[model samples]
Target chain A: MSLCEKNIFKSIFDEWNQSIQRFIQARKIAAEDAADLTQECFVRLWKNCHKVSRDGASSYLFKLAQNISIDHFRKQQVRLKYTGQMASKSEKEDGQYLMEMQEFKERLEKAIDGMSEASRVVFVMHRMENYSYKEIANQLEIGIKAVEKRMHKALKYLSEQNILKKR
Target chain B: MSESEDILLSKWLQNKLSAEEKLMLEEQYDLESLALILERQKTLEIQTVSSDQLWDQLDSKLSHETKVDKNQSGSRRKLIWVALILLIGASLAFLLLAGSEKTIQSAKGEQVRHLMADGSIILIAPGSSITFNEKDWSNKREIQLEGQAFFDVEKGGSFVVESNQGVVKVLGTEFEIWESGKQMKVQCFEGSVSVGNLTGAEKILGVNDAIDLNNQRFSDVYNHGQLEATFKSGQMKYRAINVASLATELERFYNISVRLEKIDLNKSFTGILVLNDLEKAVEYLSKTMNWEYDLNEQNLIFSSN
Candidate 1:
């Protein structure tokens, strides 16, 4: 990490490093993957600490971590494809796993794309940027109450989408 | 309509709802809402970034810009809004976040005493909160709060309370900040507190001084008397006032029935009592005022009928 990046990470470390860790874990990402994603989140925050407007901080980091998780899953798929063919369980199990991953990614993408801009920003900031209502409000120049309303709407919309429907 | 459901939803969404709101929501709403909300949040999260592409781009760009540090530093300080992000992921911080070792909790009416790894203790008041990243203790001692909390921070290094209103920065001091509703009040009990608004205006509140915030401005000023009178009393103390104001407070405190028919509505009392004692307190008023009282299970009538 560069000095700027280190400082950014350090600052984020001071602010919400815990919150991001919780978010990734809540997503059920494994321990090692969670750590990598957390580190990656800081790196992203450090690198882009200046480019995007401050309002984008929470949403940006959240989006970064989410994207990292997807990448981890995608890499896992390649590994599974090569390794599973030989030492595999039943064909049904393999098919089921692939189907689940595809469904998970698809539902997630649709939800993000479908969310209202304000709601999406709120959700992303809360989830990825690890920002609270107060921080989001400060970043966006809105009231903390407003930040809260957007978050509620975003989560409500996401939940209504049935993205986490069990198989 | 259930407060519990609202709380569960807010918790699921990671928003700040009051404890009463949380309890009401959880008690009234179905748990399915909680599960569904969590699930959707997860799904939405998984779809946001694709990964490492931005990093590769930034890597080459940063390598080329050697003198960007000074430029970025000046700009970064401008976005001090980022300081308030500390309260997120309390559960995650405990379960997965790195380098936190202390469990700090502020109860519903009890201010929690927080001893940071850096030899600092924050006395976070009731209906208020604070959490530290125990994993990162050596490098940073950060705390985030919701509602009003006080800090008697021991000296060593920088400690900050990031609230919805603004940042209360402390090198080391004692202060109480009550941030509830539209107003944010910061009172300096000892030493000095640096209060900064997001618009980048900063004010140093000295011992026994306070600043009230409205429209993002440190606009109002008060001394220790006002701060102590308001917060120290815990509840608003009304002395022999009209029934209307007392009733309003009564409604909040005890949820009792207070009906004044054929009696002086503006009649006042003399003794001072807390809202918590509305029942007995009001009864005492009735006797003093020479009024006949009818009590029927949670409902009280004060009149000559």
Candidate 2:
């Protein structure tokens, strides 16, 4: 790439590559695989930079990373099928596994919705809301022990109900 | 199904269990409960919403953002619309098949623009429908239609248009087609075009040739046969058309409203006039007929006063 194109690519990569790296880490892809995938995403973005609008570039990069992840898994599935060596689960097992996953997701949402306002707020802040426990404790004006206790109670109640497992 | 085991499983699934508690649960809980907890955790990781629900939220945000006064609003509106569209597009990608073959229809006398994949544009007229492979559009710029539209196709590989009775194919072109209720007319105003009938037989139309279809018969019309050229040629008598008929003609021409006033029933005014502006068209008609007219909000009132 020319210097200008490289600069544009570098700027875009600099802005959104962190999210891709987070996605890699969140998905628990191996460190090497994560690096490879992140690099592949940048290369793809550089290749298609002309067509992608710069305004929603973050979303575009994320979507590209997502597609690459799907492709990676699909390739892994094919390889596993040929070699008879499954990494985590067979593809059919994964399908049933996904169905179960979706059921659990629905139940989890319901459970979260049913949580008491204070407990729900505390739990969401610490978990899905991505706030530190200390931050949540400070924001809610509650003691750290109280926040942790509520989260523990919330999870225990959810698990005991087995609402997700029943699905 | 032990109560203690369920409690431990829930804690583990919630990620609220401490390191020691997690190990204890994995060791003490049955395999099934452990599997259930893993499944629950995986499910909690994804964000899924129905496309309609997501679109509703996005549309609300967009409408709210665009509702500001029209001064500093132009660029803001565009930016918000682009953001809203991109966000909706990405989220929709996550829950891919939640919306399938969904078609939204416009009310009578409405014209709307649909932004499709591949950067192509389709402007659908009132009572028209454009259907395509929602999934396939990711790979191809192809649309199947039933009714009428003006396409400003993106410049790329061949853009195919398949209708009930025929098929139209072109790389990139700006053209209008009306295909409903005993009418199928493809007017190629720019670029090259190739159209085929349902019989797998096709004909390629050049710059000015239009295909006029009557049920099974499709005939090609050259420049002289089209009404657009006559209007452009400044032939007043040749351009003269029925007033009631002119409303429908002008509707598609200017893509706006035209209200006929109290004039002679059969008044056929003949002149080469620009139909770009409805206000201007009313002015020209009023001048030619020596009638008076006023632009009242959206309505153009014409009288002999």
Candidate 3:
């Protein structure tokens, strides 16, 4: 509302919008929703700008983004009920291969979804978002060793799913 | 694998493995499959939007909100002075009209759940509203619905749901009703329901039966498997449905518009679409149907590949 508040909000937005968006996207959220959620985080900050100091803005915004991601995760869990049986259709020339690939992809997705939140976040941040170990550590405020541990756990879990072995 | 091997695999994936470490890891475990998995994972990368563009959109939204806030505060100040003078009269009016019609509405991407006095539950879908006379509900069970809702009625008296398209009446049943513009769809998941259109054509739908009314004409009753409605389950399950209808479902579920270009609307599709993630849902649909799509903001364009 005030020029000072708007400036602070803009500075925070400029500093952290991409980070917040990437954080949510790394949590397996779609890009558009992640962008919307990132905007929501900033809007929330702007509304509470009177209470939040500029120095605390980073943590406040990231916390809001984390909470939003968690909420989205819970909602996705409720919505995702994988129960549809693939219909037996007349196969085209490459239908069998395509179906096999689709099945593997679904399995991998389910495997990732089944991982613990910590490990999944770390894994996706490194693998999908291309965040380096030290960068992930700095972003998550965890040690590099911790990031490596979670990434290892995620890889182990996926390997145990035998997703690649099945192929 | 041992802890060391697991760490090695993790490092290998991160490109943190040294030449000797990579050789040791490859000797113990196959690296080719890991490469394949990583390659597949690349295909799942999420598309990102430009931060500057999003900021522009948010800036406009914030300015509009600020304007609204200022107007609301100004109005509130004026209302406060007026309220002090009319306090007694307002209290009297409030008491006299305590139990009028109650309306429950859901905003975009929001679902509202309402519980009736009779222990029945109604789940209103996004961008929908329901109005009912709560005080008189015991005598006559009825509600007017605008968009879409899932009704889980307890067995007691006859329950009726009315819309501009038609009316649905049941003794006790679980059903979903969706009405918009000139189209309406009613699906009975539990007990039987009687449906009648504005043209006076009536039909009784049994469990798992569905009927569609377009322009006040009812389609022949069709039977589907026992599955929870989309509003209740957050998943859209289609069974050999046409592409046009699927597009409509996508629009309703995500609050987005889907446009078809040089494509056949009648091509049938059967699959389950999860409604939680719009990108994944669109990706699944396009991949399975062999269509290409472009999404911009809330508009999705699909074309034949």
Give Cα distance to truth, residue B171, candidate 2, Å: 6.3
Give Cα distance to truth, residue B281, candidate 2, Å.
1.3
Q: What is the lDDT of residue B300 in candidate 3?
A: 99
Residues B116-139 of candidate 3 have per-residue lDDT tens digits of 898787888877899998877898
- Give the number of the best model, judged by DockQ: 3
lDDT winner, 1 or 3: 3
Q: Which stretches of candidate 1 lie over 4 Å from their true place?
A: A1-167, B1-96, B99-105, B226-305
The segments of candidate 2 whose C-alpha lies over 4 angstroms from its true place after superposition are A1-167, B1-99, B102-115, B123-129, B138-148, B154-158, B162-167, B171-174, B178-185, B189-191, B196-202, B211-220, B224-245, B249-276, B285-295, B301-305
Greater TM-score among 1 and 2 belongs to 2
What TM-score would chain A of each candidate receive against the reference chain A? 0.44, 0.42, 0.61
The lDDT of each candidate is: 0.57, 0.55, 0.76
Worst 10 residues of 3 chain B by lDDT: B225-234
DockQ, per model, reads 0.05, 0.03, 0.17
Q: What would the per-residue lDDT of candidate 1 be over residues A1-167, giving only the tens digit for each residue?
A: 23255445345455555455444543445444665677667666666666754445666676566445532331111000121222235643697766765675566656655665456556666765567778767655555655665666666666667665663
lDDT of 1 by residue, B1-305 (tens): 43234224556445455677666656655447546444433433322122244344434555555457667677775545554354455555656745644545545424445556665555555445676677776667567777656665667677777777788888446687766444567878567889887788888887668787765867756665332223333344333456654444344345556677787665665455443345576676577678777777677777854
Consecutive 10-residue window with the lowest summed lDDT within model 1 chain B: B42-51
- Residue B52's C-alpha lDDT in candidate 1? 49
